[model samples]
Target: MGEPLGFNEYSAGKAIVIELKGRFDASVALPVKNRMRSLLDDTPFIIADLGQISFIDSSGLGALLASLRHASRRGGDLRLANMTEKIQQVFALIRLDHVFKIYPDVKSAVQSLKE
Candidate 1:
């Protein structure tokens, strides 16, 4: 019911960078999860840019966890970047900030993957 998610893709060496925008909650988590699941087959490293994500819920957290598991199973990873203060605090409050590799920006996320 809130603003729908926006997706943008970028290439960073061997990593795939994806930017997410809007309310990242139950309203849109499934579709986003499906899309990210598809990338697990071929992509190795992923960076999820969260600069424009205005909100998140448990479902949204599940989607990210699912993606991380999928990627890790295939010896890859899903990193996070550009988190808004709100999103950042939510992640911290949930202790998920330690679960995922977080970067200040997309470039840093991609760079970490390269190293």
Candidate 2:
């Protein structure tokens, strides 16, 4: 019995911010991916706020990549912000750090999206 993964979606200007919490592992990846896909279908941009995410696994990483691709197909984009050191290391190891536009804070990420 561990804490389940949690997420919240809200709009900031034209971009949508999805705040993820708890563990982002296989247990929660698919649903989150689906949510991102749905959101991207309407919104032009999405920012994954990882400030509250404590853990992530390979499946979670895969979900993110898939969602990014989906958004791109819709002429939008997916970016990340407030990543923990461990998560950052994982992305770096997988070379996703080069693929995703990561920001130190949500405000910066949103600003980048606006511009």
Give residue 100's lDDT in candidate 1 (0 to 100): 98
Which window of 10 residues has the lowest lDDT sum in candidate 2?
Answer: 1-10
Scanning candidate 1 in windows of ten residues, the lowest lDDT window is 1-10
Model 2 misplaced regions, further than 4 Å:
none
lDDT of 2 by residue, 36-101 (tens): 988887896999999888888899999999999988888888989999898898898888999988
True-structure Cα RMSD, model 1 = 1.4
lDDT of 1 by residue, 1-115 (tens): 4488788887787787888988888888899888888876668788899998988988999999999998999899999999989888888888999999999998888788657
TM-score, each model?
0.94, 0.95
Per-candidate count of clashing residue pairs (backbone under 3 Å)? 0, 0
Candidate number with greatest TM-score: 2
